[model samples]
Target: MSEWTCAGPSTEPAYDPSDPQSGRALVNYHLRELGIGETHLVRAGEHGLRYCRTLVPEGIGVCRAYVLTEAAWPEGAELCVTVSWSPTAELCRNHTTGAIPTGAVEHWRQRIAATAQALRSVGFVVEPSHVRYSPVYHSDADLVVYRMPEGVPARRAPAAADWALTEPVPPNHQRRSWTYPERSPEDIVIQALRDAGLHAYHYEDPLPSGRVGARSITQTVWPPEADRCTWLTWWPHPTFVRDPGTGLLPDGAAQHWRDSLERIREVLTGAGLTLRTRARPWHPDTDEEVHYLAYRVPRG
Candidate 1:
């Protein structure tokens, strides 16, 4: 597991607080490093402080550039310009890796250096240790095993609804899926979809062997605006079906995928949603089938 550090100067002579352009320049310099040309300025007088918010590169996170006034610090420094990058909510949702990427850290370091340089050019005294380094962890496990912080409360698992609420369904986003080792109860899946404001259904299809398979599939259809569909399939066993000769999933293991077309047909008749399905070849090794389901959702 990788650890993160957040650093800033302990003490420094502040820059001219009356001049907001200096703050803007500091933020622009950092933005330039990310190849972003857009200028964002939050006037100091209007907000009682100056700050800039911009998207980080490679969708790693977001950067906030702000000026710390002397009044806020213990030492009567004129001003301290700070640039910080924390993961964006969306990025955090999608990234399973609980650590900041090295590339992201390097980008942040370069931006911090640029912001500090901008401050120094304006007569503010800067020090090498100006940037403080404190560790940041994405989860409690990371902290307990890595940092071993004492007196931290035991982490509790977040409720499904709570977790779902944290990630808003993207607008016009047609698909999302979740697979479980065991078949997730239909009621539970339906309730979750409801809580997340998504409409979907569950269908079970037998494999090519014509035996009742141990897989449960959920197909979600977004609103007409999204014009997209997503399928989530769950296998009860780690290996759904095995290939006799190679100890891998046989090609015919996915023959049951054709049932998805029938599932879509039912949706068209029962739910009034139109969808088209096409069968592609299945991968031999993984026994993965590439089925293309396309449709334009009917507009209300």
Candidate 2:
């Protein structure tokens, strides 16, 4: 994914003292210039903020544009805009070149330039130096962080551990199933492991066909175990698959995964685990994105 940021001096507060509605008008004007139609006005606290987002379809790829007031900036310098694009799995799947989609960089460059110009037209002083473009990894991943309870020590080696985690292919049932199962496969796996009195984490292994499945699972058994913890990832393969005829996944698939993940996070935290790092890394095998939440486990 690529990200571009532009910031400049705010000519006027989002709220126009002379006419309260003028603030929305000004925001709409700039957003229209950027071809962003859907806007949400947030009037909370002391500031009036306008948020706009749009998807721009460019040569075999799609980018998202976001415009909003920089609330952290002082009243005089609060205007900012960002545009970003990370190719979706569908786009990558349909890509014919067998490489990263071409022309994405140039497309974003042009769009960034246009956005900066639009901000300038609105009386914000956007400078060339203020515009920046850079690569962003795992742009679609979610993150959760927490700290483990104090006074717990790392686990000690035993002749045989209670459970073993391995990166195994999605079972036949999961591979063929097209409907949302009664329970999340990952949650079921974790519960089974815990039921058997084991401490473990699991992730999906990247498949050779540029696809991924529920595969990676492991006991926290690595050596040199310290206060730090390994990263745990939940790749949403089942959620990404589209329904047979509709060309879309079930409604709320993404939200369902989010809620499941949050539940898992809560469970881990309740178990006295501390999160150290949350990251999204492109899968080494499939080149697809996955999110990882890392937590420190109290050793025995």
Query: Best candidate per TM-score, number?
Result: 2
lDDT of 2 at 137: 16
Q: List where candidate 1 sits over 4 angstroms from the true fold.
A: 1-224, 227-231, 234-240, 248-254, 264-270, 274-286, 289-299
lDDT tens digits by residue: candidate 1, 1-300 = 122221222233233445644653544454444443233333333445444443344444444444432211212333334344444334232234445544544444554455445434544443332112211322100000000124433233233332212222222122133344422333333343334333323234433222211122111112223232333222322244565676866454454444543443453334433333322233434443333222234354
- The weakest ten consecutive residues by lDDT in model 1 span 139-148
lDDT by residue (161-256, candidate 2, tens digit) is 322222212222223322355333344435533543332333353221112223222112221222323335444445454566865566665554
**Residue 126 lDDT, candidate 1, scale 0-100:** 39
The residue pairs found clashing in candidate 1 are 7-132, 8-130, 8-131, 8-132, 9-130, 14-78, 14-79, 243-248
